[model samples]
Target: MTRTYRIAAIPGDGIGAEVVGAGQKVLQALAKLDGGFTLDITGFDWGSERYRRTGAFMPGEGTDVLRSFDAILFGAVGAPDLPDHLSLWGLRLQICQTLDQYANVRPARMLPGITSPLRNVEAGDLDWVIVRENSEGEYSGQGGRSHRGLGCEVATEVSIFTRVGIERIMRFAFELARSRPRKRLTVVTKSNAQRHGMVLWDEIASEIASEFPDVVWDRMLVDAMTVRMTMDPGSLDVIVATNLHADILSDLAAALSGSIGLAPTANLNPERSAPSMFEPIHGSAFDITGKGTANPIATFWSAAMMLEHLGETAAAERLMRAIERVTADAENHSPDLGGSATTEEITSATIRAIGLNAT
Candidate 1:
């Protein structure tokens, strides 16, 4: 029997729509080439524009609607006019936190054709996967303001860390490290200053370290981790950090690898209790919203992650190979990578490569 996977596509805002359009074409090409499975993608017009129209990014039943799909392919989020937090909390966070997608996985590496900013880094040297605690931490939304317009105004933003939350994420990070060839994991924390929650993060990570004896693990303060990431890129393999730290570090990782436009994110629920989400790490670039010059490789890479999450391993690897093949050629590069090719040209090249490609 042929396998059919239901996919939800949320082309959230700005270049999100552009890259998502590219993602759909690449996915269609991949399914056609694989011949073993097919995709049924449902597109939703839920984004900043929709928020402007109805005062909400999506319908009240949005989470209910997403539950039926096997996986979600998300485009970028945010807009020039909307408050960043509102756009984030309104859509992306709503889906992620609601579905309990507690593990945010981001992979950063030197693509074959791209040149790294690091002086002497090679493909294998700078390759790393960053696992972030997705559900809670600084972003748990536990704080509020006290005064309205008084001089003694008080505002507090709380970071919540529970034993259950810390333990699960640490275990997930360790298992991910064990799967990689190097079997090395770097746990990031700010335990020295933020003694409460960050300390809990450290304790749980150490406790989980005992469970994966084969994996070589170490800890780095969030500040020092940045230096280590740039100065000693090769020394790190898999990194685990809190939501805030990982968010910053991953952006730096993307820049070191090549371009921020090349990074992909997987918001995963390992237990498979709900559909996971895959998206590019790049945000909505309002400057290039309709320019047709945005890079589609990140979206393509996210699509590959979506396929892998859906158990279409062969298709996932094939899609990645095709992405690497196209990215390796600078002539087909988008403006972000310092080439002039349009989104259509690069996407077309990727789809063509998929047909001509083999495992």
Candidate 2:
């Protein structure tokens, strides 16, 4: 029996459409190569443009519509005219929170033919997977504006941390660390400054560390963690942090690895009760919207993660190797990686690489 997976692709805005189109091409190629399984993809037009036209990012029943799919392959979401918060919360956060996608996983590493900003860093030296608390903490949308449109206006965006949210993400990070060869995990937080929420994070992480004794764990203030990420890239393996903190650090990690264009993120529903969402960490590059130069490697890698989440590990591994192979060759590189190939060119090169490797 041939297995089929239904995927909801949301190419939110700007270059998102281009990069996601590239990812879908690679996925279709993979399906052809692996005849045992097939992918049924449906794209959703839900982002800034949709908001501007319909006053809604997605249809009113968007959640229900998405629930039927096995997984979601997402692209960057944002537009210059739309407020960042409005665009973000309207689509991405709404889906993640509503679906209980609590574990946000981001992998940052040096690609084959890319140069890291850090000198002497090579292929494996800066490889690290950051596990973020996705559903809650910092980005809970818990606060309000008391005196809006007034001279004395005050706005407060509260950070919320729950024991369950903290424990689950911590456990996920520890397990990930245990799976890696180093078996080391770095917990980043600002417990010293924000003593209340951050202290609880430390407490929960401390309690959970005992469960995975084999995984060596340590703590670092989020500030110091930045310096460590740059100075001692090899020392870190798996990292766990709050939603906002990890979100910031992962971008830094991406830039250090190569370019933000090459970083992929997985917003996972670990229990599999609902579909998880996969996307590149880079935002929709409005400046390069139709320039034919947006890098699609991140989206392709994101599809690879989506494949792994769907239990198509072999196909996922092949797709990743194909990406690495294409990236390894200067002729197939994109502008973001210091090469001049356009988006379609790189996409073709990647697909060709996958086909050649299969043979």
Candidate 3:
């Protein structure tokens, strides 16, 4: 029996449409190789452009449809011309929060031929995962703006943390640690300043550590984590932090590996009843949307993550190995990876490496 998966394809704004198109092709190629599964990609044209057209980023019923899909393949979100809040909060954040995708998993690793901006660090020496609390903490959307005086406005945003949110994300970190070779987890917090919320987070993380005794765990302050990420990235394996801290750290982790263009992320609901969303960690590159220079590797690797989440582990491994092969090939490379290949060229090489050609 052939199993079919329904994926909500949100190409979003700017280069989001472009990279996601590349990812879709990669997914189709993987499915062709597997032969037992098929993708029913339902395109959802919702983003800044959609907002301009309908005064809404997505249809009211679109949320319902999203809940019904097996998973969501997302592209970048945001446009230079659009207000950041309008594109980020109104669309991307809205869907993530509403869908209860509480675990944001971003994996950062140096690709075979990609060079690091950090001096003396060789390619393929960096690999780490940032497990971010997606539901709350700074991103809880709990604050408002107040007019102080003429030409002045005071904006206050609160970082909300509950036992429910803390424990789950902590457990997620420990579980992830158990799977990786390093078996080390770093808990990032600012307990010295924001005593209440971070203190609770530490206590919960300690409690969870009891369950996974085999895994090594340590705690670090947010500022120190930033410095160590650049200075000593190879020592870290899995890092777990609250929403805002993880948001910042993940980007730093991506930078340690290479270009933001190479990072991939997964927003997992983890309940198995609802579909999780997978996307590249990088935002929409409005400047390079039509230039053909945008790197597609992030989206390709994100598609590999989607395949793993969909229970097609074999296919996922094949896709990843194929990516590694293509990247490791000195002749096939993208500009970001220090080669002159365009987006289409890199993608074509990856597809060929996977032994999938358009028929």
Candidate 4:
């Protein structure tokens, strides 16, 4: 029997639309190759443009609309004209919080034929999966402002941490680490400076560490951890951090591997309760909005992750092999990966690598 998975594609803002289109093309090609399952993609036009037109980034019933889908393939989300916070909180974070997507998993590894900025780093040397506490912590939206536009304006963006939130994410990270080959985990926090929330993270992490005896774990302050990632990336394996810290570190992780264009993130619910969201770690590049230069590998990789989450593991592995085949050829790569191929060229090459003609 052929299984059909419903996918909600939200190509929010700028280069998002372009990359999402590319991901859909690759998935379609994959479906053509393997007749075991099918993908039904429904695109949502909800972003800065929609906000400009309708005064809301997404409809008020957005969560209700998205709940039916098996998974979500997201493109980058940002705009030059709109405030970053408005677009972010209005869409991405809203979905994550509402759906209880607590695990933001980002994989940073040097793909085959891609050069790392770090010296003498091989393909297997700098592979790490960063697990971010997605639904809460610093991004819990527990802050306020007083006396705006005045000499004494005070703004407070409170970082909220709950026992439930901390423990679950810690256990998730530990389980992930235990599943991997190295069975190692790095917990990042600024507990020295942040005595309350970060300290609590450390405490919970320590408590959870005992449960996963097979997995070796360590803690690092967020600042020093940055240096460690750059200087000694090979030493790390699975990294777990707060929402804000992981957000910053993952971008650095992406860049260190080669380009932000090569990294994919999964905003996962992990309990099969609601739809998980997958997207490129890189943000919407306004500079490359209309240009055909935006690299589509990240989105392609993201699509693969979505497939794996949907339980189409064979299809996901095949799709990844297709991407690797395309990326291995210098002539088929994008400018970000030190080649000059356009997005369309990369997409077509990937399709060809999948043993199909782009239709």
Candidate 5:
């Protein structure tokens, strides 16, 4: 009675293929080691290269094709020659919005061997899981440009905030906060300026906070929140923000921890009606495309998150322990982490580390 989990792997563009390959290899090793379950992974050649060939990143049937899988392991998106918005909308956003994968979860922490850019921060000083409202908010894709090339051309990209969307994500964030040891959550908003939607976010957060008296929570302006993230990293536990703000903050969190190469994100539906997509937040770096210097840690971490989402908690923990083992050695650091190890080199080390564990 071995459990078989179907996974969709999308190595979107540039170094995407390299890191995704690394993740698949390590995951294969884990599957072989565990022997209790199986990963039936399907790889899709849908990305910038495909866009260049067909004017679309994925086909019309791509979303429906992915519905049967248990989870998705995404590499990266963005291409040197293709427009970022096109690549984003065509593939990633299409899958997310279509499937209602509305909760974007990004966890950042200082791994053992990595040195933080923050002056005195260490491992425990910066551990934060940012829960972003994924489906709507600034990224709701609601506006358009009226005049293409006119000097007085008008354009508007609307930010949508529904009470339904806000409440669900806030409740999700509070539950996540309750699960963490600190039992603290910060609701990020720009209510003072954007009084309408953002104010609703504040009201809903307060309403949600009342439901969880055991959980300590507060609201912060997005601007001041950024300063707090840097200056007082330890004080924060779990953070919940709108789409655009969390997008910016998570990148900064990655840099402060060590590198964007170490950041992983999970776009979840939470209801489990649709397959969740897990990916590294780092965009494609064409400069490192063929050089093998792309760090695979983020992809590996993303794979670990996917494993956890699939109820393979044991295997997921095993994968993360292996990652920490590799990151604990500076000699295993990729170029992004200021060492010269190639992607394959680091992957090999991670696989070997995975083999060392008894479980």
Candidate 6:
């Protein structure tokens, strides 16, 4: 009675394909362990490249395929030639919003052998998660350009907020904070200025804080939050912010930790029947495509996050410990981590560290 989990594998454009290939290898290795479950992966060729070939990102009929999956393992999704709106909003954003994946969770932490650009910080000095409201706020596709043929043409994009969206994301953040070793939650908002939506965010965060009495809670304006992140990131645990704020803060957090190339994220629809989409925080690195130098740890850890989401916590922890072990070993690391090893070398080391054979 082995349970088989169907996963939608979207190896999007550029280095996305490269890193996702590595992630698939890692997942296969995990499946090979003495476990009661196996993975049935269905790869989706839907991205900028596909768009060029088919004039569509993801087919209308293909939505059913995505919905049928147990979970999704996503790669990056942008290209220089395509409009950012077409590459991101039309495809990746459509999937997430349509699926109601309201919580975007990104985890940034210093790896054992990676060094941060920040002064006086040792390896493994940072660990934090940014919980973003994914479905709404500034990301709500609500406005467009006006007077396109006139001299006074203006473009507008409306920012929206709902009580339901705010409340659930806040609750998710508090719950995540409780699960972490350091039980601290920070809410990032621009409530003083962006009164309509951010104020609601603040109100919801305050209400949620009362529910989680054991967790320490705090709030900061987005500007101040950025400054605090660089000066004292260790003091933070879980951070909840609107879509735009969270997007910016998470990138900063990734840099502070080590590299954006090492951060993993989960776009989660907690109430959905299907599992969430897990991916790395970095985008498709077209400049370095096929260079064999892209680091794959982020995608590997993202697979760990996916495992955790699937209730395979023991497997997830084991994978993470293996990642730590590999990173800690200076003799076997990718070039991005200051080692001379190639992508395949580092991935092989990670597999071996987890007691899996690199086949």
Q: Native-vs-model 4 lDDT?
A: 0.91
* Model 4 collision count: 0
Candidate with the larger TM-score of 5 and 6: 5
lDDT digits (tens) for residues 44-65 of candidate 3: 8999888888888888777678
Estimate the TM-score of every prediction: 0.99, 0.99, 0.95, 0.98, 0.98, 0.96
Q: Once model 5 is optimally superposed onto the true structure by TM-score, how far is the C-alpha of residue 356 displaced, in angstroms?
A: 1.2
Model 2 agreement with the true structure over 7-103: per-residue lDDT tens digits? 9999999999999999999999999998989999999999998999999998889988999999999998899988998999999999999999999
Q: Of models 2 and 4, which has the larger TM-score?
A: 2
lDDT of 6 by residue, 1-359 (tens): 77788999999988888888888887888777837679999999999988998888888876667888989999999999998888897678888888888999998878887778888875445678899999999989999998999999999999999999899999999999999888889999999999888888898888888999999999999999998888887788889999999999999998888777789999999987655799997899888788888888899899999988888787788889888888787886666666677778878878787784222
What's the lDDT for candidate 1?
0.94
Whole-model alpha-carbon lDDT for candidate 5: 0.92
What lDDT is reached at residue 237 by model 4? 98
lDDT of each prediction vs. the true structure? 0.94, 0.93, 0.86, 0.91, 0.92, 0.86
Error of 1 at 31 (Å): 0.4
Mark the 10 consecutive residues where model 2 has the least summed lDDT.
330-339
Give the higher-TM-score candidate: 3 or 5.
5
Residue pairs in candidate 4 whose N, alpha carbon or C atoms collide under 3 angstroms? none
Off by over 4 Å in 5: none
Highest-lDDT candidate: 1
For candidate 6, what's the RMSD? Answer: 1.9
lDDT of 5 by residue, 74-180 (tens): 88788877778999999999999999999999999998799998998868989999999999999999999987899989999999999999999999999999999
